[model samples]
Target: MTDTVADLIARSNRLGADPKNTNYAGGNTSAKGTATDPVTGQEVELLWVKGSGGDLGTLTGSGLAVLRLDRVRALTEVYPGLEQEDAMVAAFDYCLHGKGGAAPSIDTAMHGLVDAAHVDHLHPDAGIALATAADGEALTRDIFGDTVVWVPWRRPGFQLGLDIAAIKAAHPDAIGCILGGHGITAWGDTSAESEQRSLHIIDTAAAWIAEHSRPEPFGPPLPGYGALPPDERRARAAALAPTLRSLASHDRAVVGHFTDSDVVLDFLASSEHPRLAALGTSCPDHFLRTKVKPLVLDLPADAPLEEAAARLQELHAAYREDYQAYYDRHATPDSPAIRGADPLVVLVPGVGMFSYGKDKQTARVAGEFYVNAINVMRGAEGLSTYAPIDEAEKFRIEYWALEEAKLQRMPAPKPLATRIALVTGAASGIGKAIATRLAAEGACVVIADLDADKARAAAAELGSTDVAVGLAADVTDEAAVQAAVDACVLAFGGLDLVVNNAGLSLSKSLLDTTVADWDLQHAVMAKGSFLVSRAAAKVLIAQQLGGDVVYISSKNSVFAGPNNIAYSATKADQAHQVRLLAAELGEHGVKVNGINPDGVVRGSGIFAGGWGAKRAAVYGVPESELGAYYAQRTLLKREVLPEHVANAVFVLCSADLSHTTGLHVPVDAGVAAAFLR
Candidate 1:
């Protein structure tokens, strides 16, 4: 029944990868095996544990930090009576079994002290729901018998490891131990055995909860708008999104996405939501993500969008004031003050719910965890009077230096981390450049194009991560355009930036321009831009977060060429579209701008679509020299690369342009003729 070292590693990855088990990398696992010391040529017992904040799902052997079992245990004894948490951490690090510098988990010592050969720790909801309740220990022993023991919450340190070891000595047959207000630690002789024991505990506890708990949820009134028609529902979302977004944001733009399904409504509609929600998170690790509590926003659905938005602005202000009050109540004179974040979750009765983050991924994760928190609280309350560790414990876990270590290793926030953007015609050329640039800056981007496969491929090319998603959307089709916006929200949580970059280019004299060419250009450029801008604006407004819509227009909007009537005329319409949007959306705090880039033939699909030869011929230059000719035409004599246009979009979306809107910024390398007058 014994599992190999590699088997333990694989098992840990599989368990950690599932957020249902642990939201993000919040748990650790370890295995004991015999290995010869490379230098000493002597066999020793080694313990390999999940490193700090490492993702278990994709984890490999190297992801684990190896420590000598004797050495790990020796630290507690040699450093007995240690009072500070930092000293234990240093001792654990000092006992690393190998040359690798990867930090051992704070729980590494906890794992080492266990008697079993394999230990798998997790933060599964069901188990945590049972472990963190007011009657947690009583219920655990009742449901699990003597296979596990209860270890009261202790700020993790060397003392914690010693305590767990003492409990294990008392219950030698115990397969797991519940860490109060934290999680479960299940151990066995084999990887499968350990996982099976953990899952059994989770399932049995879930069953107990299901049988005993049926607490109902009741949200504040939403008015008749909750039963509004489909169009009305969409409209409702559009108007409300921006107000919440604005209230959540500070100096920079912030976005939000809704969780409005029956499940969410059930949580919001809970008659006891105010009391149940204040019950705190079912798991301790969530303190870092969800905070101690969620901010609830209740707005009447029937209120005019503007009025509701205005009310939200007021409520959010009060929410911040209350948040500061909570912080001021809990802070100690000895510690540095912990800064508060915008509410991680919001509840709007009759409307729905939302989770906020710096960007789409973060928003989605927060939302997901909030829902899980609701479910756990419901289950716990339905069975027994539910209780979680108080505000004091939350502050301890959330501010614990060792616990925050994983987050400290995270890279600095990218400029657009909280923003979600969708770009039309993103499979190639300028659109592609913009999407890639946005992803690099930490925005979650969606690529929409007529070419479904190409769009997906382009998204894949950007990376395997969720930074970019692809959708096959014909911007000219109203339904397709709406679907694209929906897809962006589904993937990224909310939409903040909408780039109308999909357009058709044709080179023809006024007399030679075909009716078909003109219609096609208008459909994709003018009409497409209108469709996408309107759809995206709805989501942005619903988020209540000010946003940006950057149009990838052409220099022809200002300096029309003789033969390109189709492209020039439609581009002018696109340019005008920006002004119209800005005029309408400015009151909502959304900025609309245009980037007029010239000489974009290098990466533009226009060259591949036969425009290069035609435009070169029209300009009386060799086809190979067309790009050079455009560069020469620029006052700066610089090639107007797609990257230049992408940078212009960044600038337009940045806080630098927060005050400037409804204006065209030329990205054509200083073409004086195309300059905005």
Candidate 2:
């Protein structure tokens, strides 16, 4: 990369990496420099601006759009009015220097039309506080004096760019200007100067708010609105997350995120929270993620849990109705169809906030945006009456065709997208394979195993927290099982699929078997499956979203292998539980299924635990050839691998098998003795 572009990237990263400077993927940055034109062999001025949907902190040269400066400036001659501004984005393609680096964002015109070598546009909380204040224009004058100007509210497009360019021309000495009811844009002749000015502006505004603003901005907490103790607050959040996720998924399924941070609790408990939340966020970027407003539950923190849950259901219904009315109020004949009537952010006094999205990252970011909104509200309220963009303007931005087109550009989701799964004993062996497969198919997985470190390592291989998390759980202990289930709920919302894969084996004749052997095998396989299923069932049923329960029973469950009384009986128990639960949970749309795999010697924890030697002796073969010996007996004569069984779990839980529940899929290389019949 050229030094100019490299410097611009460093500047962008420094500004964007800090939440105090900008929210995730919220702002854009640009640098103007000369580059050799490949065809003409002449140096030409070009604009390198952050591309559409690119995060500034992680921006690279590939994530920037390069356009000929002359072509960009020429657009002003053919500039359409505000009504036709969106068309300008298409025009940017014609301005490309060559093949172009990335797709130009809507803010491209703002960066290109400006008269500067370096520019930064950010949504710093303090700056937005002044931008959204009721007396914002005057506040800008009082705080920034003539060094910064105030531009009236204008939706981002070619018009806003032209407006900023005009202001810069009028005030040559001014370093930047606060874009009214939006964010702050600063520019300078050099990259360092531009970054410095941006920080100075943001820091100055923050200092002003801190020094001059009135105290008790959020007002005192109401009677009974004090935050619940940390433990109770978290437990309450976990209990309510499933129901809230269900409500949020009324239109479509969504993953959820919960947070009871000090800031959120303080905001929710304050007397002024209801009014401020109802007025909604002012910044377009903030509202786009958080929604126009949050659904605030009008209940105390210490209320009865049962009452709180029932009230949440009632409040959720009202939230949807209100959202529908809002859509009706502003939708035009040409407006995009209503996306959904569900709120992205939900607020409960004393408890915390719940945010939902198609996946975990989106949900977590939505909550983060709301916290940014809360900071903006605090600043604006402290200085003057908190004011945001007009409701009509917010609607216009929320339903903008450009925004809809952006959504359309996103890749289609994977098969198990938005599905959350919990896999027991997933640190290694078949369980880990199942977890890996599920994560690859787009489900956020919880790798639960007795070995905590290995479970964590296995989960780490899957991906970030958005994809998988690991925890310790001994299925024999009911509390540990419940905690594992609850941890899944806390990590990525609620559970949609549970894989009961934790198992052990003992190959002893009935006469040789002791009570300890029978009980040990039964505890881990039979009672373990029961404990895990029961714990996860409460969450799935509470979510009211249909789910899947897959048991990794053995072929021995039905094959009646000799000298394996304890292991065989437990597998039988697991096999029967699948059938029985299928009958009981069909009304709730829960599918229960089993995968019966034999000769899975390689990578098999059971075999590695000495069961292979015992089984090899029983079959009168060397332990080294146990897998082949078992495979030779099958009709297909194929060795069963962990991946094969994982594939079976995927198919059983996949939409293709939505109607094929209460079934056993045998992944034992066509062993006729273990066939479903």
Best-performing candidate as measured by lDDT: 2
Tens digits of per-residue lDDT, candidate 2, 1-677, equal: 99999999999999999999999999999999998998999999999999999999888889999999999999999987887888999999999978889999999999999999999999999999999999999999999999999999999999999999999999999999999889999999999999999999999999999999998899987889878898888888888889888989999999988888988999988899999999999888888988999988899988888898899889888988998898999999999999998889999888889998999999999999999999999999999989998899999999999999999989999999999999999999999999999999999999999999999999999998889999999999999998898889988889999999999888999999999999999999999999999999999899999999999998988998889999999999999999999999889999999989986899988899999999999999999999999889999989998999999999998999999788988888888878887
Predictions in order: lDDT: 0.77, 0.93
Worst 10 contiguous positions by lDDT, candidate 1: 216-225
Tens digits of per-residue lDDT for model 1, 1-677: 22566797778777877666766766888888888899999998888888875777777766778888888877766764744656677777677877743578777777898778888778877777776678888988888899889888776666777788788889988888888877788888888899888777777777887776653413343334344454565545545555566566753455455667665666655556667666667476675667778766555456676777666777667867776776777666654445555677777755677777666656666777777777667666666666787777677667666655656677888778778889999999999999999988878889999899999999998885457878899998998998788767656556788999997788888898889989999999999999999888877776667789999998899896878898999999999999999999998789999999896878888786898899999889998888889999888888888888999998888776689899898888788878788
Best candidate, TM-score: 2
Give candidate 1 misplaced runs (Cα > 4 Å).
1-4, 17-20, 78-83, 211-235, 251-257, 299-311, 403-408, 472-496, 514-523, 526-547, 572-593, 619-641, 651-677
Models 1 onward score TM values of 0.86, 0.99
Alpha-carbon lDDT of model 1: 0.77
TM-score of 2: 0.99
Model 2 regions more than 4 Å off? none
